[model samples]
Target chain A: MNDPVAFVSAMKAIGAGLAMVSAIGAGIGVGIAALGGVQAMGRNPDAAPLIQTNMILGMAFAEAVAIYALAVALIIIFAA
Target chain B: MSEVETKKRRFGFKRWIVLALIALGVYTAFLGPTIFRPISPVVVLPPEGTGLEIFGFPITNTILGTLIADLVVILLGLSAYRFHKSGQIVPSGVYNFFEVIVQFLWNTVEGAAGNKWGKRIFPVVATIFLLIFVANLSKLIPGYESFGQIKELHHGVGYAPVKLFTIGSLNVYTIDKGQPVEAGHADEEHAASDDKSAAYSVAAYAEGGDELCHSCEVVPFLRGAATDLNFPLALAISTVFLVQVFGVWALGPAYFEKFFQIRALVRGGILGSVNFVVGLLELILEFAKVLSFSFRLFGNIFAGTLLLSILGALTAVLIPVGLYFFEIFFGIIQAYVFFLLATMFISIALVSHHAEEHH
Candidate 1:
């Protein structure tokens, strides 16, 4: 049988791996948000010009948070 | 009763036929998860040259896709329209939809570049938007991307070809665990095939690799065009550069003041730190803006393409059928947003040194 402490640590590593998978959620969220803005711009031609710049800005902020989460997960995986 | 029946009969057949065809196209191709058969990429390995040869690196498919998108747009504008018009109805429903697309683009550029300059950039922005949008949507087409033969190394394995044209045969190659690589193989092949053939090392197969890999088996053939950073990054640079070009055109030598407004703050004194910091922030923001623009489009489109592909492959029929329409809508919107934001950045960059507006 594997040592309890080592098994516990390995399980922690596995948990970290699963946490990194959260990037997938972030990915889906980001894509949906972007599509929502894109759809809005398509419907209203006049508003699109002004809204698009803001849309990109909003997209980047969302993506940045996701990326930061990814970075943390990566650190945990490597450090562990 | 007679008049009503006649009117319904006149239009019924044509509308149903068109809808049926659209439905058929979706069911067969966009049946995502159910489609076990592989699709081919719209742009494939170059039979000739690639951009991967600078110091010998793998040139990504995204760059190749961008090049193809640019060419396709040129050909499209020069030759055929996506939707036909004329005596039928003059700007059919599709045409009106696209006219709206153009208007959306115009509003974007005009809003960013202002009414005066927006009109000037409308054509360029629209072309870029439409071309990229179409290229993205093209990924949904079935049989568009497929695997091909194991390609030989060029001056070695470092450089990869860009455009890939699916050939009659897709030969699978595998590298057996132990095999020898022959030097001067091109010469060796010349002798074996009467000196007219290109040499391919069976070494990879010798170690154990499948023969016909779809543009590097790890990545799917039907990839979204914007997934790789190269296209968006190159576009960001071009857009930002154009902003400077217009700045010089409009403000002459004084354009330098936009970046270095050191003179404006001499009278303000101690708040000079704030001015200096803001100036640095602007400088940093320029690059950050480029990074954001590239990553935003690349990440969003790529993730969508990847999910649709994965989901479509799993379910095959119904689920993917619905997503195709959304993808079409998405393609147009993303392109417009990208172009609009670019126009906005450029216009902001070109503002006069003496402008009254203070942020």
Candidate 2:
């Protein structure tokens, strides 16, 4: 039960799983942005394309945070 | 209206038959056998192009992909040159397509750099965008990830290649004549002792059995170049290096002052100390940008390919198609993001501190 190799592997797997938890934050953030965009669109429809471009750009920035977490998870699994 | 409706109705039966045949053909060719007995798609984080040796130099599948990308760039360049030499004022066909893309890229650089630095920086930004875009989309080609040299592994011997081919294979004459070959039995004994898995060392295919082990394999070709860490890392390093050079060219010794802040450290006031520390942090962040840039592109593309292969394995029907389209969209977006980030970074470096403060 206390074997070192097995313990290390388990820890790595746990760390990777934990890293993925960041996606929840990113998901919520992007969802809120989209909701705001939808509400704004309802108020004024002429700014649709402008709103969409900004929304996508913002979502990409948000997604990059998640991607960074993924990179960390990958490093733990592969590099370690 | 009646005539048009009659004409449309006339081809309906034939069109449906053709569509059905195509659907059936696609099913059998790609996903039919895998449905009955699913195959686990090989998904490794790091690029492991089949370990092919050529004149003792290791050649990876990513290198092959990069070579193909270079060929494409060359072809595009050659045609553009030909079009220029032809002196055609009005372009058509492929040249027109090239003109539109180049014009769009130029507009982007011009937007970022204004009229001044756009011409100077246009080549690098446009080339990176084109290269990455093509490399990303290349994965969408049919049999892109599927076709490759498959390797068979031995269980106990632990990755003993049963059958393999490389550029070295073509130089069999040199290998035979240049070096004295050792005894087979002696070599086998040496290898077995090195691995030390004698208990499980039953020759899985000793009796001239099938060369390929069903499960243990490696594909040596057609992986997207951007999915490999080396390509993106190299690109990031070059971009960061060039950005710094551009900063120096634009601002001369003043650019170095932003990074070093020797004057701030010497002054030793509270603001000066803070500014100096921030300068150091900025220097560190510059290096960090390379890490973020390389990993972002590599991780996204690699994960995308893995997602696709997994999807194909898990389903026989329409689910994978949706993901395929998603990947296509993502490839374009990533290229655009990389382009924008690069241009922004360069432009940031080129702009002076006073100019920023004024704005």
Candidate 3:
């Protein structure tokens, strides 16, 4: 922390690492969504296409949080 | 009055066995040794394209890639038009494929933009989708980026040798009679052996002490267009600009009211002030949409390119095939998202406040 350049570099690295922690949340969220989708599919096979589309859309949105985290990490590493 | 519960579907025993076999196969594939030596893949920003200068303007590999995509699109369009004009009722080959794509895109846009505006915006949205889709998928073609010209390094030009996939020392070159000459020729009994001022140049791309005297660098001729920020930014700006123009054409002078809210301020009350501020905020949000739109597509596509290049550098074998498939899917989804977002913006603009209240 005494050296400004070193401190900033360390902090940036820490920030990038912290940003990736959101991936854990995103993973859990997607897994829960997929579980629900699977249960729905099991219960109503006829509504498979509609359910699958919605499920994938939801998963994409959820995964977007992870992508955001990755973008942040990239910016921190490169832009910093 | 009753919940008519459908019976739960279960996978058959044969299906379970197939799934298990596939899982095992994938696991074993991962367990196998890597095809190439493990190296920390370097990720560079603002992707380095071959700086090919044409009349003082440097054209990038990404631009070349875009040009290739545009050419492909145009050629296909011309062929499709010919096929249509021939009036073959039993559509086959390119005609059938073109019809299917166009019909699908039209239906999708029509659903989102409604029947009236859909016809107006279909060309713009479909063109963007097709161009991006082709550009994205074009990267997967073999030798699309891997083949290029090898440039020889000259002395006094600050060329730092970076690591390449190959493992060999570069051949050293020396100035012989004012020309770069390879040093290994013992048969040349030139009297220059006594000259200490002769400059020796060597190029090597790794951190090994065994450096080659003369090194050449490969400049890839093609790169994914979306991997560059310029393409996405230009697309986003044009899309948003077009949306605004369409809005003005549709709503006339009333369209500016969404941003300025002069009418709201003139009819002043506490709510009118809030509305005016909200209008300003909404205007700023529109610009933010441009940034978000460009960055989202640019980030996803660039990241995919980075991933593929890194994977390709790491292993020369079967590992990257799965990645290629995933990238293809991701590219298609991004194109769809971009198309949908543009349509949504236009539709949102088309729906004025007065029109909604009249309903």
Q: Give me the displacement of residue B15 in model 1, in angstroms.
A: 16
lDDT comparing candidate 3 with the true structure: 0.70
How many angstroms is residue B75 displaced in model 1 relative to the true structure, after the best TM-score fit?
Answer: 2.8
What residue runs in model 2 are displaced by over 4 Å at the alpha carbon? A1-7, A27-61, B1-38, B49-55, B153-211, B266-268
Candidate 3, DockQ score (0 to 1): 0.15
What's each prediction's TM-score?
Answer: 0.58, 0.77, 0.69
Error of 2 at B287 (Å): 1.5
Deviation of model 3 at B354, angstroms: 3.2
TM-score of 2: 0.77
Error of 1 at B167 (Å): 9.4
Ranking by DockQ: 2, 1, 3
Q: What does chain B score (TM) in every candidate?
A: 0.61, 0.78, 0.71
lDDT of 2 by residue, B97-125 (tens): 77888887777778777768878787888
List lDDT for all candidates, in order: 0.58, 0.71, 0.70
Query: Chain A: TM-score in each candidate?
Result: 0.62, 0.89, 0.86
Model 2: pairs clashing at backbone N, Cα or C within 3 Å: none
Ranking by TM-score: 2, 3, 1
After superposition, which runs of candidate 1 have C-alpha atoms over 4 Å from their true positions?
A: A1-80, B1-64, B79-103, B147-223, B357-359
Give me the candidate number with maximum lDDT. Answer: 2
